[model samples]
Target: MALAVRQACIRAVIDGYQQAAISGLCPEGAFEAAVDAVRMLDMAAVLQREETAACAAGTENIRREPGSVR
Candidate 1:
């Protein structure tokens, strides 16, 4: 998770730098914000998968552990 988060941040920074370079705008916080936005998306997907797995397991009388849920 930490690796993924770091990679996301790096990608965002690169994206922001590219955008700023192309648009002549300051890259300042754009990268950080973009990274945060992407992480939020990733987190959402993980949560959705967990929810789905939980529902499925519950229906079958099986309990899914956190790490193994997805």
Candidate 2:
């Protein structure tokens, strides 16, 4: 699910770059650089969310374990 969202974000960013390139507003390498930045940000956000979820799940598991006394 997160992967799909990230892929969609990448495609949207690429489309935006292509549109800017078509408008001749972005200089050479600008569109590609923008796309790369967007991709990096998207991946970073997705990974952060995934890590948070994993940590929460791990904590829950530990709390629920049979030997857990607290």
Candidate number with greatest lDDT: 2
User: Cα miss at 56, model 2 (Å)?
Assistant: 29
Against the hidden true structure, what lDDT does model 2 obtain?
Answer: 0.68
What TM-score would every model get versus the actual structure? 0.40, 0.38
Please give the range of 10 consecutive residues that has the lowest summed lDDT in model 2: 36-45
RMSD of each: 8.8, 6.1
Instruction: Quote model 2's TM-score.
Output: 0.38
Give the clashing residue pairs of candidate 1, or none: none
> Which residue runs of candidate 1 sit more than 4 Å off their true CA positions?
26-70
Please report, in order, the local distance difference test score of every candidate based on alpha carbons.
0.61, 0.68
